[model samples]
Target: MYNKGTIIPGLVIFIVFVTFPLWYNGLNAGTVPKPDLPIGQKECVAPAAEMRDNHMKLLNEWRDAVLREDDRVMVKVGGKEYRKGLQMACMQCHNDKEKFCDSCHTYAAVQPTCWDCHLTPKEAASKKETH
Candidate 1:
């Protein structure tokens, strides 16, 4: 049997180690959204154009890195590299994909097909551990 004093320490540990992450993730989950370009910019014009260009550049770099099969760039867990496909999820870099991916997609009138095919990092990590 545990002492009453020990129970308080154990509860503190649980709150710090377990409940904190749950609360943190819950708060962050809603914070990710896509980029929002200026309104009425058909060709990604003006200041918004620069943002679009930068975004495309980043995406292209990511694509190129993946095509080169650069395992070194892959996401690491316990110092192990995950495969490219498994690592390509939006949250890998853009932790706020709801804010980053969705916001830009809405502005561009383009529906990202990511949700149609890909699982989120949280989901993927969970599945990975079970397997």
Candidate 2:
């Protein structure tokens, strides 16, 4: 049989590295996915489930429509229509991107470059307020 001392240390190291992600996430996990609604807000333009699951997709579509195609049209879902602009529509309710966007993004360990182009209302307001 192989040496138990070497086998145990190697096994322990393997498990630690393998489970590092889980432990790290657990340590950092907190009330991220809680109600990220603005004060006194009722509902989003799209449903919460759709927004949570497919926000990036919708953003990509919006980017393409706005930038590449120049096709700024109304987005209709569930018998409701919204003008397709991140800065115009989304930031209306989700103005606090640090709380809403950063919370979920941090939990999921994804670094979305949404703010690279589209500025949050708070940030824009700060700019306007300062200048």
The lDDT leader among the candidates is 2
lDDT of 1 by residue, 1-131 (tens): 56979998888998888778676777565543445432332332124457456755654565667767564355443344444442453344444455556675765577755566567656667899999
lDDT of each: 0.55, 0.78
| Backbone N/Cα/C clashes per model | 11, 0
RMSD of 1: 18.4
lDDT tens readout by residue for model 2, 10-123? 999999999998878787655646646777656776687897799899888888988899988886634556677887677766778888888768777999888787777777
Which pairs of residues collide in candidate 2?
Answer: none
Query: What lDDT would candidate 2 get against the real structure?
Result: 0.78
